[model samples]
Target: MCQRMQMPIITSRYWNMVHGTNPKEVQQDAEGMQVMQVLGNNMAFGLNCKNVAMKMGLSMPEEPEFTYTNFIH
Candidate 1:
């Protein structure tokens, strides 16, 4: 299954420098996500990001930044 990941602090609207990047997607919903380290507007990590988030016990709309609710698998 797909999911979300830890977005960089640069994602804040004030720091958005990615040419056409739009980091506003939740759950990698085939939507756009802001990429700072990389140029161009695209899904930088794609589903791989979801995997990482899962491994890290993360989910969409990362609240408390580094915290995740217990989701039963």
Candidate 2:
């Protein structure tokens, strides 16, 4: 009998969270990307946050827990 071998591909890495590290480490390298670059790259985050607050008839909390726990009547 013959058997077939298979390999798996992994896409995500935890090191992506750290900031400003080159080949030094995968985690630091990936995470180190600019902040505004990431945020500005994705417009939906801000709009989505605002929409959620508006739907609840709530305003941006001063403390900014951003939970939108305040329900609008």
Candidate 3:
């Protein structure tokens, strides 16, 4: 979906997920916490970069017109 929308997809060291039945259990998942942190940092960095680019008068690429296709008649 992100690709289709030409949006940046943030990622981490692993899948952005935490396995737990409760908040306490989730807190125990060290790896999951790390992944979340990494994702957050990445997103922040990306946004900062975009902001800087805009300040420099850089603009986003123009989006092409969309074409629809139907298989059913």
Scored by TM-score, the top model is: 3
Instruction: Give TM-scores for every candidate, taking all chains together and pairing residue i with residue i.
Output: 0.23, 0.27, 0.84
Tens digit per residue, CA lDDT, model 3, 1-73? 1123377788899999987999999999999999999999999998998889889998777777778999899
For TM-score, candidate 1 versus 3, the one ahead is 3
Candidate 2 structure quality by residue, lDDT tens digits, 11-32: 2322224443455564454344
lDDT of 1 by residue, 1-73 (tens): 3434456432332343423334443325332234333323333555566679769987577345356778898
- Which residue pairs overlap in candidate 3's backbone? none
* Candidates ranked by lDDT: 3, 2, 1
Estimate the TM-score for candidate 3: 0.84
Q: Note the Cα lDDT for every prediction shown.
A: 0.45, 0.47, 0.86
- Candidate 3 shows a clash count of 0
Cα deviation in Å at residue 33, candidate 1?
22
Task: State the local distance difference test value for candidate 2.
Answer: 0.47
| lDDT, residue 36, candidate 2 | 34
lDDT of 3 at 67: 82
Give the residue spans of candidate 2 off by over 4 A: 1-37, 60-73
